[model samples]
Target: MGYDLERFVGYVNEGLLCCVCRDVLEDPLQAPCEHAFCSSCIHGWLVHHNTCPEDRLPLDITHLRPLFRYMRNDLARLQVRCVFRPQGCEVICALESVHRHEQQCDYALLNCSNAGCPVQVSRRSLEAHLCVCEYSSRVCSSGCGYTVLNTEEAQHNCVSELRAELDMLRAELDCKVEEVRHEMESRLDSQRRHMVQKESLLRSEVDELKGQLSRVMSDVRILLGAERARRQELERAELEKAELLELLKKEGLRPATPSEAAPPPAEVQRKLSPRSLALDCIKRKNREVTVI
Candidate 1:
């Protein structure tokens, strides 16, 4: 049953009340049996029983039709007090507008957010109550370590609080400074070790490269020496060839022609001699003169 119905019993008409909820019909519905009920109330009743509440007859939610016209007209004409009437809300509104007013009612009860605070006050007074509530916890505006109630907050000593905070902050700062120093030292040590390793590696690579360069230089020297020796040998061979050619020329030892090998006819050979050749030339001239 609705709590409003009990409170508004004398003011609400029986015809406008739902049989199931015993409250004024919010959204009235009429069954096929011509029996009217709040839509929610009839549906809830139908959950366990398939029969109408007024008459024991089989009924289904589908058989219900809206009575909006009659319910709205009746609800608009009915006047109701605020749901927070007992909580000092004196406002009265039409039944149709009651939900809207109650939704915004300042007199509505509000529970305290603090878990340790069990008191509830009207929404309008909640802020005032929180200001004085011992269970209400709030941060210190003076930058203190402790959260205190509003009532006790004014009694806090800013001088002592700041001193304690300074001490705590100084300790934290020291720890942070030491931590940062340690981190920096660790990083520097790591970097130094890395640099040392890199330097060692570079030195090893340089030594290896130097050895390679030395080997290359040695190979170049060997190749140059071998080239020089080969050139000297070639030059010596050319000189010897020239000397042999000179000796051959002085000795008149040349390749023999076919004529030299077979020796010319004796007559031709004799004519080749200086005196015989001159006599032949004279005789040839005399012969030519006689022929002429």
Candidate 2:
């Protein structure tokens, strides 16, 4: 196959391709003089005379080359076998396409699900592999360890904002609860004071009513006593008056009073006696009453 100049220059700059027999030269070797060549080319040149191609220095198998060799494949893998046989990539592609298959293969992986994640994925199927991958999600900026889903990037940002708002609400609620508690305590204290004042007023009113009731009872007792004494005096006076009228009726044949003494008719004057005249004199002076 013809060599591509651009690819050849790139391989050279990378120090991965051999200078001679340059078709991705395999089995690189080094001379004791610190010069390098392909293993086959080195062996052929050494058969003629044991000397380095770049420097005419005597060579031996024991020395490592001073120039750094671009490592192509491991020593144990030199035997002919499919590159991806162990990884379930059964396609037997050459070494060039090995790196390509490893990139585009379904089992091949480049990195974690998080695009900027720095971890390397050693396994396959990124979806199934990263499902349980701890490094697959972006960290929460809210200082929480909670991981955000890949499909919910926008939603997670929204939730982060809502978490800030929730903190504010909690603070406000605490303030309101304290305010309400203080208001209730104030109301309870006012009610207690009012109750004490009202109790004092009621007790005073009860005392005044008791005093009024005692005065009214005392006045009634005094009036009853006075009424009883007045009734007795009036009864005595009535009896005395009745007795005076009876005396007057018995002495009807004589003059009832001195004021009644007058010149009588000649016949009536002749019938009057001296004893009757003395009794009339006592009755006329209004001194004849005897209560005994």
Candidate 3:
């Protein structure tokens, strides 16, 4: 919306008046056709019609631009009264400075600072109103560290409020403690599972080693038995050799040479009588024992 023309201290240029609101242009924007209007007025106008409000020329929001620099300078130099003038503010300032003046103006209306307050008072009276406003808040004098509204001060129960706060804190602490306990239990369960798995793996390895050791022991035992048998055979052969040598010495028989020990011809053996064959077998046994 444009500023009210009556608020100005002196004459405002006709060109500075918004074509839509017919008031002094506020945040003026210019169309491509060189027509100026308040930013708000033009936007609202364009919402219903896409043409310029004044000349009805083909126009759009995209065709709007800030006011020309010369027009803006002239607009800023125009003197204007405070917006709170009806509330006793008599300050007159350049249009550019009017906003700054109104912000700090004592006549400016402000809502009551207390929550749920419905009263609106001038800045100069707000402090006095706060002193007596029933909706105003104040710290509890009961040492409960709570702020209570003035209207509810008489009914406020400091002890009950404090007890409720304490209960809430206790519940929160218990929840935290329960969470920590659960976390610890979960961790312990995970560790226990890991330990059981590791123990099983170790036991399996030990069992495997034991199986290998048993197999190796069986093989060693078999080898030892075979070695023992071989040694016993050699011992028996030696004993037999000793016995044969003693028999030969007692009978005054001499050991035969290798050539004399050779078997008789196959034809001769075939023709031998049973008695001769028996004597030949005895001599062969004696030679085998001598060789051992």
Comparing candidate 2 with candidate 3, which one achieves the higher lDDT? 3
Estimate the TM-score of every prediction.
0.52, 0.34, 0.58
Give the winner by TM-score: 1 or 2: 1
Let me know the TM-score candidate 2 reaches against the reference structure.
Answer: 0.34
Model 1 regions more than 4 Å off: 1-81, 86-92, 103-106, 110-119, 123-156, 251-292
- As a whole number from 0 to 100, the lDDT of residue 228 in candidate 2 is 100
The lDDT per prediction is 0.75, 0.57, 0.87
What lDDT score is found at residue 59 in candidate 1? 96
**Which pairs, if any, clash in model 2?**
none
Off by over 4 Å in 3: 1-11, 17-24, 27-67, 85-92, 115-118, 156-161, 197-209, 216-292
Q: Rank the candidates by lDDT, best first.
A: 3, 1, 2
List runs of model 2 lying over 4 Å from the truth.
1-156, 253-292
Alpha carbon deviation, residue 29, candidate 3 (Å): 5.6
Residues 1-292 of candidate 3 have per-residue lDDT tens digits of 9999999987788999999999999999999999999999999999999999889999989999999999999999999999998888889999998889889999999999888899999999999999999898889998899999988899999989989999999999999999999999999999999999999999999999999999999999999999999999787666655654564564346555675457755664664455355555776776666655
lDDT of 1 at 82: 87
